[model samples]
Target: MSDSINIVLRFALYLDLMLLFGLAAFGLYSLRGQERVSGAQLPFAPLLATTAVLGGLLSLAAMVCMTWAMSGVSDWIELWPHIEMMVWETDVGLSWTLRMVALLLAGFAVTLNKRWPTASLGLVLLGGAVALATLAWAGHGAMDEGARRSWHFITDFLHLWAAGGWVGALAAFALLLRQSEPRLAVLARTLTGFETAGAVIVVVISVTGVINYLFIVGPSITGLLDSTYGQLLALKLTLFAVMLVFAALNRFHLSPLLENARQTGEHRVAVNALRRSMVLEFSVAVVILGFVAWLGTLSPEME
Candidate 1:
């Protein structure tokens, strides 16, 4: 039961941070100039501020949970010392401190949205990326020592960023397409821009994911099916492939359909088709994140 709760906390925190980073990045790259702040593109200030605040609070909860599980202390009096020691002495503690500081500054960044929109969003993106990257310390990479540790950590960071970017864009798309009267022109442009970003994101995720796997599981594929971690990873990879299919469909089929509908005056049908696919793709992405959170808790060898 405690393990389940820990997984839930980790999953929530992962989702929150990924969205916080991805959404900020999506706003910066997908939208242009006054379109960014006009309330027409995205409600940047309130949306980002809410995520930043939530991410920090969730981080605290997850940290406390980890401390409790590690120290086996029921009383606050005893747990307090353990918590303090972990916070000041360990690498996880340092990462948490940096993440909390970054999240706090993300709040301050949102305040600059009115006058310095670009800088504000850019800072928010940077903060979100940092916060997300720090989660690597809580993963399998943290169990390693020496130069392999650094390489693994670097790959983990890149993997997180790439995955976060893809997830964030899907969310932004679903939100935008959910409106009563979707903007066809803007949606068209955004989809095209996403095609470019999506390609890069896919490449980075694939490469770094392979590297991280090699670092953790080595060159062995024989024991993978016997381990719970590997089973979940297999499921994650299958879902990712499904997401890729949807992405290709969106790029090849729905996108072109929307373009044609724009000229033929049949916007409703085409837009709805694309919207359904986006929602489904986003749903699968969330499921994959859950598997990720669970896999992080298990051994990839024989557990």
Candidate 2:
């Protein structure tokens, strides 16, 4: 039961932080001129702020749950000392502190979004990155030492950011598609921007994924089938591949159809197709995140 709670918290935290950061980053890069300001069609600012707030709350809950799991103490009064010890004397605690601080600032940034769009977006982006990066301290990377630990963390961080970028952009894309009378021009532009960004994200995720796998599971293919961690990793990769197929359809078929439809001033077909594809892709990403959360709770070396 405790393990289930911990996994749920971790999954929630991961998804929230990714949306918070990825949405902000997408707004900064994809939206242009008036599109980014107060009168913009998309409600990205409010959505980002909401995600940030949720991420903050999830971070707090995750901290509590982690302390409970580590100390094996459930009573609030009895667990106080153990929680205090973890907070003051551990790397996870320090990382949690950093994430909380960043989340607070990010929440504040949302309030200023209307008054100062550029500055608020910048703050949210930076804060989100910090909050997301801190997750590395509590994951498999933290098990290493010295230089290997540093490298492991670097890969983990990059992998996280890349995954966040992809997942977040999919969310934004879905929301945009839901707009009452979708703007073909705006959709085309956003899709084009994502195409470029997605390329980088895919490359980064692929490279860091291989690096992380080597670090955690070494070169043994048999280990993948023998352990829970490896099995979950394989499942993640399979889902990712399915996502990739959907992405290719979006880029090659649906995106081009959108462009042609825009030219012909008839885009409902393309729009609906893209929307359905995004829904599937987003669903797959969520499943992958679940696998990741579960994998984090198991030890690769134990196999």
Using lDDT as the measure, the top candidate is 1
Scored by lDDT, model 2 comes in at 0.87
Off by over 4 Å in 2: 301-303
In candidate 2, what are the lDDT values of residues 242-281, reduced to their tens digit? 9999999998999999999999999899999999999999
| For model 2, the run of ten residues with the poorest summed lDDT | 33-42
In candidate 1 the C-alpha lDDT for residue 280 amounts to 98
Residue-level lDDT of model 1, residues 93-144, one tens digit each, is 9999999999998889999888888888899999999999999999999999
Candidate 1 residue 252 Cα shift, in angstroms, is 0.4
Model 1 ranges off by over 4 Å: none
**TM-score, each model?**
0.98, 0.97
Clashing pairs in 2: none
